[model samples]
Target: MANDFDTIKKNANSFIIEIHKFIRENFQVSIGDQKKYLDSVTKDSVKTGQAKLGSFIISVSDVLLDSMIIIVYTFLFLIYKEHFKLFLAKLIKKENHPALMDILSQIKVSINNYIVSLIIEMIVVAVLTSLGLWIIGIKYFILLGLITGILNLIPYIGITIAGIITVLASLTGSGEISVILGILIVNIIVQFIDNNLLVPLIINSKVEINAFVSIMGIIVGGAAAGISGMFLAIPLLAILKIIFDRIESLEPWGYLMGNHVPRKFAWRVRRTKTQE
Candidate 1:
């Protein structure tokens, strides 16, 4: 019995030692592998961050340069406005000068009206947005509303970005799903009213552009010159429409771009009657 007990004690001690030995061997290898992985990840993250920073700096520099150029050109144009008119007059016949001047005046008035209407729309949108956010108990509602108003100038994508920003801001505070939902609902309702009512009454009335042309212009402008292009698209299209309408050969194109919708079969019946 003594001999059997001794053998059992020796076997149990050996089993424990073997388990400890196995753990010790594997633990060192696991720790070394984990350290290597962490080091690699840290190095990669630093490289990626540096690349992003460099790209961001370059973009900001380009934007600043563009802004400075635009400011300089605006100042020059304001200072030499009559000189530009004279140059345009010189490009055409003397008899056509009056017509050309009339076109220029029309263009100036249209652009002014469009800009003023946009400002009014912005103010309206800002007030509505602030009121909505305030009602939802959102933090920094005024600032967010102002941002939404500014972004709203960018056309279709602007409102979407505003919604995302508002949702994110709400998340930072309460982080509640209900707050996020409330923010979204408010934005949607405001956007709906702005699009259906305010835009038609204010912007569309001034610009006289069809929805299809406006959307296409924004898309093409965005693809060509980014955000600035999108913002300028409507005014530019309006200007083009004015020019096209003045030119006899291009009147059809001006009509095509305009918001005027005729009866479905009116044109066809008119053509048949003319033939008869």
Candidate 2:
């Protein structure tokens, strides 16, 4: 019995030592391989980051160059505004000069009003969105609201993007589902007010564009030039509408783009003898 006990003790000790040896050997090998992998990853990441930064710099430079060119062109146009007006007048007969002048004046007024109204709309949206987000306990509510207001200028797509950003920003805070829901509700309410009240009174009244045409224009513009195209679509359409309405030959096309409902489809209450 004593011999058996001694043999069992020796076997147990050997097993423990073997395990310790195995762990020591494999641990060193694992650490070496891991270090190599980390080094490789670091080198690759640096190269990738450099490439990304280079691309970003090129894109920014191009944008800046284009913006500068536009500013220069605008300055030149302002300096020689009367010359351009005379140039346009020269294109038509002297008899049509007054009409052309009238058209140009209308265009100027429409464009100016549209721009002013747009700024007002942006301010209203930003304030309302910020207030709602703040009330809901969202962090960075002001920044998010400002972003939303700017993006809202893009028509249907802008508000959707703003909502997505607001929700994501909310996630960084409480990350609660209720908070997400609150964000959605706020966006919906704001959009409702903007579309129904603000747009009708401020923008649509000045532009006089129908919803169908506006939506189609936005879609086509987005497809052609992405976000910039979408942003310019409405104003361009409005301008086209103005031109079309002024020209006798293009009146029908202008009517097609306008929000005027035909008399046949108009709702009216017939007068009854008692009511009369």
lDDT of each: 0.79, 0.78
TM-score leader: 1
Q: What is the lDDT of residue 276 in candidate 1?
A: 100
Residue pairs with clashing backbones, model 1: none
Q: What lDDT score is found at residue 87 in candidate 1?
A: 95
| TM-score of each model, paired residue for residue | 0.67, 0.64
The window of 10 residues in a row where model 1 has the poorest summed lDDT is 1-10
Pairs in clash, predicted candidate 2: none
Worst 10 residues of 2 by lDDT: 265-274
Quote model 1's TM-score.
0.67
Model 2, residue 227: distance off in Å is: 1.9
Tens-digit lDDT string for candidate 1 (79-118): 9999988898889999988879778988898889898989
- Model 2 — TM-score against the truth? 0.64
- Per-residue alpha-carbon lDDT of candidate 2 for residues 108-197, written as tens digits (9 for 90 to 100): 888788889899999999999999999999878999999999878766656876887776566555544567779999999999999888
